[model samples]
Target: MMKHGLDPGDRRRPERLTRPELTARREAMERFLHVATPQLDQLYNLVCLSGCNVLLTDAEGVVLDQRMSEADAAQFRDWGLWQGADWSEAVQGTNGIGTCLVEGRQVTIHRDEHFHTRNIGMSCMDAPIWGPDGKLLAALDVSSARADQTERYNRLISAQVAQTARAIEAVFFRASFPEARIVVASDEGGDAAMLLAVDKDDLAIGATRAARRALGLEREGAIRPRPAADLLGRDDDMSGFDKAERAAVTRALARAGGNVSAAARALGIGRATMYRRMARLGLGEKQP
Candidate 1:
């Protein structure tokens, strides 16, 4: 079974961030909302479907825009929250968005993470959004009533919140620079070999600084255009590969449970070729 607090919504874990540690995150959130508008609205709507309240905060931990259930909205308003409310721990004490910003990782804080007694009825999960230069961009948070009987409901909402955060990131990335390929580099390890972002046309968009270094580029460059087979080591047998290579690699990796060697063998390719495919094609560490 999954640990309660290590990865997701764990209630049994030790407390992570102190009150003062959240100051910087709170400032960042203050700045993010100043510049984000229409897209922020879309993000709010995306999380609303999960029956959770979504908050868009800057690095500083201030609440910019909030979307909540009808009753919850009324309660929040009754609490005197307006458009410019600051929910940072320094101001409001520990909470999901605030703590995640301070911790700088994805986390789930069941009611207990809240510093205030009133907030204990909520379960909140959050992930930090990052910018192109890898600076903290914003905090995406989802909060729902913990009194609900179903753990599945909380899990579903948490997943939706995470997806919404990614969607906002994708939209922000594309909107900021429509021409730039938005390649996703893995958040873990900062590996030069992994490429995370892919364009709609199935082309690799951006490569991480580490990846650029591995690719032998002096400076950062585009995600690089290479056939799916080239990355997966099937390039040598071009005649045997076709448009389905991407889908094939994806499914193979999934079936192999993320074992690249198994995926390669299943595809009749050497393990080395599989590695090349992972890097060249920009597949990150994820099994999918």
Candidate 2:
């Protein structure tokens, strides 16, 4: 508020973007908007089941799309929560979308957490959606009027929102690198799945956020387009053949639920061939 020259007690709405400015921003985000529109629609639909409103914004926190029920539309609009509104930290203070973008992670801002007094009745959850290059592309936010609820319940909802954001990031990553082979990796208990993108030459071109974290790529400062073996902790050099074989076998097993015969049939290869390849690739004991 001090940076923006606003008083602490101010309840005035922030300045909105002009028509031309909004148009330019939309045009700049055309590609991302195209890729995110369908996913955002699905996300909005899913969240609406719980009477929540969904908002999609670019990295700068300019609203691109929003979904709200008729029951809450008027109230939200009155709060200036609509398409093209600016919700950056500079503008809206400490709201969910702005704080998530600032922190580069998921956040839950409930009631009094909001800097603006007028927003004290709102509860919001937001998570950043990252591109294949590990850059912030956009954010996904779900918000509703504050309600009396246990902290545990609110945390559960926050987790759900973060999961959905990760799903969007994964989808966006796959779309950005459609030609790359996607290798699914999971945590110890196999509760979460992360995607690693390997090029035809067995190089790791990209990874989803979860994959990056699981593999410790960020800590290692591993240059992107690096060797897949480096991230996977494998010493053997991965030939093109090895990468292709592993990808095929992993996908087949995933589809077949670890049934070697079914996986072979799906790949149009003999069961013996599948078993031999799986063993060679060190994937024989790996469960999908």
lDDT of 1 by residue, 21-125 (tens): 445444554444544555456656765654566777767765556667776676555432324555555555567776788787777777655666666677777
**RMSD in order of candidates:** 15.1, 6.7
Per-residue lDDT, model 1, residue 71, is: 61
TM for every model, in the order presented, reads: 0.51, 0.74
For residue 167, model 1's alpha carbon misses the true position, in angstroms, by 1.7
Go through the candidates in order and give the clash count of each: 22, 0
> Model 1 misses residue 38 by how many Å?
6.9
Distance from true location, Cα of 26 in model 1, Å: 14
- Where is model 2 poorest over a 10-residue stretch in terms of lDDT? 184-193
Best by TM-score: 2
Q: Tell me how far the alpha carbon of residue 280 in candidate 1 is from the true structure, in angstroms, after superposition.
A: 24
What tens digits encode model 2's per-residue C-alpha lDDT throughout 138-157? 88888875366445665777
